[model samples]
Target: MFSFCWPALLFLPLAAFPQNAAPDAAGGHSFSNPATAICAAWAGPATDGEKMRRFLEALTLDAYVSARHGGTGFNWRDITSLLARVERICTAEPARSLAEVWQERKTAWHRGSWKANTVRCREILAAGDCNEDAFFFGIWLYAYDQAKDGRSEATLQTLPQGGGAMVWEECERTPDARLLDVLRRMQGK
Candidate 1:
């Protein structure tokens, strides 16, 4: 004779599973677009340290790709430095949302004047033996920095051809393969 309670059998599988599984089953969180994912993670509830670190690393890669697409021939040192700075800032202000902290940083820099920043960007471009790539990279970085500084969203809106805006718009529109690569490498997958 076999006696099985159907309700108990049904409940068995559910009980074996974690009651509070992470929102994202594949990972703690997942998104088709890495940039959007990073931004969302930043704005979302508190996450584990490892996850946060991975997000920062991905953000660094995204920024690097964005700059390169704009034609900046930045050295590894520069990229690493930027990553470290951003990580430090974000780490220190864990309570603040990423958007809020980013806005605050932008405001701090914008107070210095967008015109001056733009001029400085040009000077940096001119000082170097800039080729077409370098020139575009400079423009992209300038626009991105200005946008971050809260100078004007229009800078992002109307950037000239081969500028940061172009790359940014593309990133926003679709998932960047390079970004996925970076994430995969970070995850050791």
Candidate 2:
């Protein structure tokens, strides 16, 4: 009996560990960089939808701050490129490179196609159909939650218009707390 149980006991601790636990992929959305860290401070515990919004928001805020300092504006092309980098870091897909996904997302954005935008994002999360992957699922949840809250429009508008960079020149800036509050409520905290 001890011999039979030994195998089970040996594997019990391993079972408690996450099977997919791997180090975060290098590049894109790492917590190492100062800018990413500032953005992540608000994003760490956020839901999937919140993560996506925050990711998009970071770009907008960066542009806003840059422009406020009298710098040139950021273009959609450049912003999309940055997002592509983020996509690469967030997932482990070989096909459909983040750059490609970024372009697809841009196309949907220009068409004013929310469904397409959502579908694209969902694809990014799953990297394919019917995926149950944790990271993808998490980000998808963020998008879904953001949509349900009716805050996407406000966020979209807050971004610079005409593809130019936007800067918030104000010395003091705060993230939209309502969004964060909703996230906390969703998290049951």
Candidate 3:
């Protein structure tokens, strides 16, 4: 018979590894919320904070599209709240500041000031030096220009929703099996 418990000893440590993983570290894990848990697992060091920020950007744009074209099915209040949730999960200083600015823009939009939204987006773009920030600015600019030409309504209705649903789906589509597995596990739980 076996004289040693080597197999059991080896398995014990491996089982403990998951629980011991760090948060925000390289290859670390986080679970800000169930929804964000999926993002955290799906968002590894490579994607981490920045990609998550982009996902928020997508959600913001989706809300705008829904509000403008979904026959008012969406609300700016909901969009601002969603952005705030994303900002909290992202936990990056820049994201926090962006969230505040976004909230202000949402307030302005509610007050019927589209120019305020445009200005806020421009300010965010100016403060950052990356595609993610630029993307939101571009999206807002596209909306602004289209609104000016009275074509945004048609575009908004045609656009698909991009909040939680879109981000999670895209995360699942990522090539990394580990990230995919983590997201799957979170979704199942």
Clashing pairs in 2: 48-142, 49-142, 49-143, 63-166, 64-166, 64-167, 64-168, 65-167, 73-165, 74-165
lDDT of candidate 2 over 1-189, digit per residue (tens): 011121121222222221221234542232221122322223223365445444444443333333223222233334435554544443444233332333333322322111211233323222322222322222223333444443332223322231111111110122232322333344454
Models sorted by TM-score, best on top: 1, 3, 2
Q: Which whole-number lDDT from 0 to 100 does residue 33 have in model 3?
A: 20
Predicted structure 2, TM vs. truth: 0.22
Name the candidate, 1 or 3, with the larger TM-score value.
1
Per-residue lDDT for 6-121 in model 1, tens only? Answer: 12222222222222312465554322222222333333333453443333233333333333233223332343344445456655553434333333333122221112223332
Error of 3 at 24 (Å): 41
Per-candidate alpha-carbon RMSD to the true structure: 19.1, 18.6, 19.3
lDDT of 1 at 115: 24
RMSD in Å for model 1 = 19.1
Better of 1 and 2 by TM-score: 1
Better of 2 and 3 by TM-score: 3
Error of 3 at 97 (Å): 29
**Model 1: residues >4 Å from true position, as ranges?**
1-25, 28-97, 105-125, 130-142, 145-189
Better of 1 and 2 by lDDT: 1
Q: Which is the leading candidate under lDDT?
A: 3
